[model samples]
Target chain A: MISIRELHKSFGPLQVLTGVSLAIESGKITAILGPNGSGKTTLIKSILGLVKPDRGVIQIGEQVLNGDCRYREDIGYMPQIGHYPENLSLNDVMTMLQDLRGGKHPTDTQLLEKFRLGKEMDKALGTLSGGTRQKVSAVLAMLFNPKILILDEPTSGLDPVASSIFKDALIEERAAGKTIILTSHIMSEVEELADAVVFLLDGKIRFHGSPTEILQNTSESNLERGIARMMQEAVHP
Target chain B: MRTTGKIIKYEIRDIARSKFVLFYFVFFLLLTEGLLRFGGGSTKTLISLSNVVLLVIPLMAIIFGAMYLYHSREFTELLLTQPVNRHQLFRGLYLGLAVPLALSYGAGLGLPFLLHGFNAEGDVALLLVMIGSGIFLTFIFTAIAFWISVTYNERVKGLGFSIVLWLFFAVIYDGLVLLVVAWFADYPLEKAVIGFTILNPLDLARILLLLQMDASALMGYTGAVFQRFFGSFWGISIATVALVGWTAIPFWLGLRRFAQKDF
Candidate 1:
């Protein structure tokens, strides 16, 4: 479980996250929905300890989020855009990561094979297309089989078939009792996967409940319209 | 330790495949041949060859090494989130860069020695002093590069500052020291000159190596003073200790700053 309390952060004079408090349960898929510039990414990075919060405490299980804590060991992060060294081949990257992790992990060939990346192992990362790069990032994140997965724009560049493949893998991950936190603007994608929805607007939590409950609160028939109406109301109010 | 070794291996591999390293090796090979032919390959050509290693190589190493460290900050930040400490990261980077330094210099200097059959049973102590002083000079510059890279987030700024520092060490430093000595010529300034030499790794390296070469007699009054102060075994030992300080101080500061950096 992930717990954040009274989190406050600012970049210079621009306040990003203010008294942000939330809990993410294990074995559940939570969709963090927010309009652009609404602190979604900030919150994620703060939890990852990449961004320091001015005033707050974050806990992953019993361990607090400190510089030395190995809470990161159980967490896998898929950045919004994955950047790799231009000359690095896929296999080279995998081997390097494997070695860096000290060969402690079981061989994770399933994700590579599933994504059809085995054939492209020798190709340079710079030569790969955006979709292919995303596939590689996705594969690396899941390869370690971490108990917590934090993915930002996880399916942004995927084709429909690849998207299906990703969705299936996420579902399997959830079934195996992993905590999955995903951020995406695609309402349909969120609706299809989210067990709980946390809607954020202007760095504030506008709504937090089941997806059905969120839709009901906005009195909308569709997830997209519900999200739009909620955001609009949050702004106007 | 295992993870640190892995980081070191990958860093070395990355540097080994760099275009600049390849181009540098090729260019140095051609340049060495041209310069040797121009000098007609004489021991009297120490000035030209010394300028290559002293002035040119240090300049290039500072720029390329600083740029490499700065350009990889984001990647380093990613690694920090893993199960690795700051000291381990620093150890890996230092070791990784040191490998390429030793190999490239070995190739550059060794090639000429091989072709010319450069053989001399010079003082063993002085020979060891020369090699130690040269490598220590490289270490000091590399540490300076790493420190600048960590202090500045922008690659261009890092490279710019590092180049300026290298220029100061390579040329301006000696010029300023000459002016000071000229201004104070009447007093006993031998100790002051020795202290000034300790301030710059390049000077320390030159003094150590020149003592080994036949050109020590040609360095005039300043050379005589250095020979008097640093001619003994204990004197060279003191200079080596000072050179080690040149490496350790900058490196320790750089590692400390990098450990505390948010990224």
Candidate 2:
């Protein structure tokens, strides 16, 4: 389980996260949905101990995430746009990552081979297409079989088949009792994967509940409409 | 042990292929040869070579090292996501750059020495030229470069700032210091001038070698004071401490900021 409390952050004078708090239960998927500059990314970074919060506590299970903290070992992260050194081959990257993680665990190599990355493992990372890079990123995120997975815009450059396979893997991981936190603009993807949704606007949680419950409470039938309704409610309420 | 070793190896492998590193090595080697030829194989040639090499060496170190830091921004984010600590990562980066730079210096100077075998003076010259200057400049600018990189996000901006500062130290700073001393020449300002010398690494370097060249007569009363203070073991140790502080302080801050930075 991951728990965040009273998280506040700002850059210079422009406050980003403002006393935000949220929680993730074990063996579940929680999707954080918000517009650009709404502090969704900041929230994720704070959880990972990348960004220091002005005020708050973040705990992964029982251990707080801080400087030199090893709580990162439990989380696998896939950034929005993955970038590697231009000269590194895919195999080199994988081996380097495995070395850093300190041991080899079960990676979904069969699926990766199916994606045809096995054949081109020797090719430099800079030469790969965007979709291929996303595939590599997705593969590494799941390679460790981490207790928690944090993916930001994971499906942006993926093909339909690859996206389907990736989603299926998330489902499998969730079934096996790992917590997943993902952020995406794709409503259909969120609707498909999110067991619950946390709606954020202007660094505050507008709403937090099941996707179906959010829609039902807001008198909206679709995720898009539900989000729109919540944003409107946040403005007035 | 295993993880830190892997980080070190990976950093080495990545920087080994950098185009800037290749360019710096070739350019400096050629520059050194050109200066030797221009000086007509005289002792004056060695002095000129030392001055130029020291000036150029630190500049190259800063530019290339800064490039490594900025270019690897996203990759750093990826690294942080792993189970590695910031200190280990920094050690890897520092050693990685230092190894290649040290090798390039050796190769560049060694090639020239092999072409012309070392006499007593030539060996001393080469030791100061290749070994001393190389290590001193590398340590000085590696810290500066890493500081610029971690402090700034934009590549062009950070590098541009470093270039301007390099120009000031290598070319303009001495001239400015001279103007200041000349303006205050009547006030018995030898001690103040000596004090001012501590501010610039270039000046410290010049004082080190010039004293060895036995140029105290040309350097005047201020020279005697400089030689009295800086000529001693304490002076060299002081400069060494300052240079090491240059590395330690900035590296400490950069690592601190980097740990809290949102990649």
lDDT winner: 1
Question: For each candidate, what is chain B's TM-score?
Answer: 0.88, 0.84
Which pairs in model 1 have colliding backbones? none
User: Who wins the DockQ comparison?
Assistant: 2
Per-residue alpha-carbon lDDT of candidate 2 for residues A66-144, written as tens digits (9 for 90 to 100): 6765777778888788887778888888888876776655555655765677866889989998899898888877777
lDDT string, candidate 1, B73-155, tens digits? 64576576555767788878877886577556656554654576433445334334444555676677888889899888887
TM-score top scorer = 2
- For each model, chain A TM-score? 0.96, 0.94
Across A1-237, the per-residue lDDT of candidate 1 in tens digits comes to: 899898898877998888888899999999999988888988887877767778899998998877673577677787788877777888887787667777787655676788898778899988999999999888877767789999988999999999999999899889999999999999999999999998877677778889999778888998999999988888787
Candidate 2 C-alpha lDDT tens digits along B1-263: 56667877888778767655677677666765665556455355555666666677778888878888887776677787888787787767776786678677766655654565444464465346345656766767877788778888889999998898788878797788778888887787767877667677766666656565665664444446787866656655666666566667767776676665666
Cα-based TM-score, every candidate = 0.87, 0.92
Which segments of candidate 1 are over 4 A away from where they belong? A8-15, A52-55, A199-207, A233-236, B19-48, B70-81, B111-119, B123-128, B181-195, B214-231
